[model samples]
Target: MCRWTRQDRQRSHPLNIQRDEYARRRRQLMRMAGEDAVLLVAAAPERIRNADATWPYRQDSDMHYLCGFPEPDSVLALLPGRKHGEVVLFCRERDPEHERWHGESIGTERAVELHGMDDAFPIDDIDDILPGMIEGRGRVYCHFGSEPEFDARLLGWMRRLRQLRGGGVVPKEFVALGHLLHDLRLYKSRGELKLMHASANIAAEAHLAAMRMATVGRHEYEVEAELMRTMRSRGAVAAFPPIVAGGVNACTMHYQANRAPLRDGDLLLVDAGAELDCYASDISRTFPINGRYNREQRALYELVLEAQLAAIDEVRPGRAFDAAHQMAVRVIAEGLCALGLLAGTADDVIADGSYKRFYPVKTGHWLGLDVHDVGDYRVDGEPRMLEPGMVVTVEPGIYIPPNDTTVAERWRGIGIRIEDDVAVTRSGNDVLTANVPKDAGEIEAWLKRGMS
Candidate 1:
């Protein structure tokens, strides 16, 4: 078995920003939580992949956003006005034996020194110690339902406080932390944008690599393998399961079976992204397996490209969050009608939602730490207006399943989606993944480079 060396760890470190950035995030959260509020956030639990083995450990996005501490069985507590400390961390204690077998850990003391937590404690003591911090606060801010065990413990503490209400003032209210915290996270800081840009860059290279690998007679997994190799070597992992769908498989969104062999004149659709420094980049590109799109494929590809460009152009500031989706829908509906795929006027087809048969998904979603990152799409019952510093995806597509009888025989089994990571700016939007070619001719030329 291969073992990881120090160099391997060093290469994977995307912590280019100063440690104080995490401190700044905590400060922001504390300000939002208010002096009378107590905030509780838990680190993600390690998930078991199989018998006696674990999947790769990834920290919770909310927890990692507040503090860059990467470890399991940890939690963060924020008491904004406390004299002893405003921020506290409960984390794993250092045990030499455990470190030898599992991995080295950042113990409590260093958690304070290195990570800027005001105080720290062993996770074992949290059960005994945390409730006391919650005792007199007016409100508790935390994400309930995210961790069921933590939710039960929180409720238990509340019940205990209720039972002993006569003894002293007890925290009386529980509020969801996501309301304020996620809003804060929705807007990216300059450093955060830089990290996201880096992630997009890596994902773009991986997409190009996968494109080069998708030759006729090759299994879909071969392209996926090329992607994984590029990602792992560069210290990134897939933000989500990569969709390496070939031919008919492309018609199914979220397709996972990468066992099909690519055939000449067939198209491959890859929806994959990379996660770097906890920030994610999502990109999807459709190209030909034989280095060229066939006549029918090219017609559908150009239509989808037109719709995508229109949708992407709608990603500027002040536009409604749904504007991109609406724009894409209109474009797709109009194109389908023009191609004789639909019989009515574009207006009628879109008005009645008949176009959903071909385009069933929204144009895109917010992009960040999670591939489908968190942010309120609607605010106060209205579609939220876009603002600068927000990043979102502009993906527009059409999928015609192989067995569908509604469309022409040649048009079936064609799925084309063009997605790019876009960042809203004061003037307009920036396409972070623009380096990867999306044009039909551009893609064909790039694939030809591999053959040469």
Candidate 2:
């Protein structure tokens, strides 16, 4: 078996995000917001993990997408064609005492020098100052309800500005910033793709490690620990809480309680990802607890893999957003009917949603910075067409819960999901998490040989 040390993990990944990348993103967003518009985006607020302690602060995805400033209690206001500057940042001020206890502050002075901001101000004066910036704008493109407290404050600013309309101009229009901003973010840049590729490779290694360590007697959390160690050792954090569901536990979507004991003949489904440099890669794999799968387990696993592969084929440019999901549903429904899990024809099962008994939700979702990343799958309530540069997950699953008496006893209590992160290209799709094997035969060989 191959042993991976933290030093090895450290050397495997390098960050590629440059300062200019964020600046370009800001310029792109400004183009979306016209000359007379002001786009207000707030930083993610601090939360109390416990008394006096705080949760690990992560910047808002939209805010971070435009400006790569990684501090808290900050806001970015982009005013195109403004006299002084286009990018104005409001952030915490420099306090020697506070810095001594907590950490360094990206004071207003350095915000302009280091982060390319046109002008900067202390967050202390936001209420008095931000409204002035908001005044005389034709359109206010802002995240209206992301931060409720900030939302109320913004409303107050708008109300106060409305009162002063005798001389001052309040924004005549309020447009949701996400509509335009998310669309910009939906397409990945070269830097973003590089980060996502690294994330996916790291996650693939973690999954292989988990598979190698898993045994009949080991607990689900024990396997989860292996995954965490592998990711953190590589300096990437999990995109989300891992779903290390074993046997019947796998039937529950979004299963978090990973304390179940691994059974000798049961399947262990692992759904996890690594987030490298704020870019996320999500992948899922299902394998037997022991080295190899049993007869019935292999049969069901192969069916899911078939559906997932067929779905991935739909992840190409000009295809509809739901094309992959529709493909997966058709394949899964047909496979189930052929296997006698469903009696009706594939078309009948799909039309009546009889396949929901085994397959519950759509195949997968968009994958990026946030796990369920920002992007509209629909425009004008119609399915949006998939385009080049969009990354999506192709996950098709079948869960036969233990209590459900619909299926045969052999088929019940078996759940399987195979997923991979695919980036849509002009010609086809690129699988970011391809290093991780979803095929039963390949997974068994890898597990037995250990990262060969």
Candidate 3:
């Protein structure tokens, strides 16, 4: 069962500088749109199993970025190029009857106060109120292909405006809001950094806990449960589904069944993270389930760990985004050649794309509010340069399938991945999740301590 501790409730770390930061982002987006107004909506309520059952609701990331409010059927409208032009939110009204079955609703009044909105109104009255807001506005800014329901509603509103063309009402243009917000979010604010750091710390601790709990005969799910418990105790949630693959299961990337029992000679690969204050931390670690790695497993693990460290060393401001990936690929290619897993020279294997037989996926990705954060790497359809305040994951792995005959029997089914959260800095990169024990010695020590 899920447990919520007293400390979770008592310790309140309300986000700081949230309002000002959000306002600045909205202003930038407004400037980019070159429009008089923009309209954005939060995620609508979703149906679950049946009409009687509904899924737990979470607000859209873009909406939360602007308003920091998590409620269903909410809207944010921004009017730009005008004095006193800012943000307004339309949300659910107060209803004591509905509150009885569900829970307390923030209501319109408190939403304006808490969310820093210029004005607030009941969401039910959107149709009546929106036309007035849209009137005389030349262009409307919103994300296309996001929400089908919202798309239908936007079309309906556009049709209504078209009907009023004879009545002296028209919209000259429709712009994609994604371009504006994506650009703004690419650079992390100080407030966002704090939350991301906290998330990294939490995820690091959870990984430590999983490492300590792992043992021969323990099911992978048991270790996953321990990690979940640790996260919950710290008032955090999983950034994604915890991947706890043991033995041959480790060869499968994105393996999350987590039901297999660990064996004496098997390796365990765990890819998990914690989400704190909506910011996410992604981390992965692989170790021996029996507290000591055999020679083959140790060699593979060290190579992968070395490749990860080499990649991380390349993370810095002004560097190409692909630098770390290239470094890791080179290291893995050389390692495979040394191990006789590849026949030809490292250069030949790498150039011919034969190295992908061992490492199929990219080394890592950007890590932030979402596990894979937004912001297209292309400016004008070109790779974006790395800059300060950007956070990313440096993970390098080598997976040897159980059925593969290229390597020795002992080396088969041994998969290893080492990941860490890195924040690009003015001088270099800071390892945000450094508190976790990652080195082979430190991991072994942690396991021993847990056994005692």
Q: Considering every candidate listed, which one attains the maximal lDDT?
A: 1
Report the Cα lDDT for candidate 3: 0.81
What's model 1's lDDT at 443? 95
Residue 304 C-alpha lDDT in model 1: 91
lDDT by residue (129-181, candidate 1, tens digit) is: 88788778999999988889889988777766666647646787889999989
Collision pairs in model 3: none
| Model 3 lDDT tens row, 134-210 | 77888888888877788887877766766664653656777787767866776788888888888888888898889
Taken over the whole model, the C-alpha lDDT of each candidate is 0.88, 0.87, 0.81
TM-scores for all candidates?
A: 0.96, 0.94, 0.94
lDDT of 2 at 403: 87
**Of the pair 2 and 3, which is ahead by lDDT?**
2
Candidate 1 vs candidate 3, lDDT winner = 1
Stretches > 4 Å off in candidate 2: 1-14, 159-167, 450-452
Candidates in descending lDDT order: 1, 2, 3
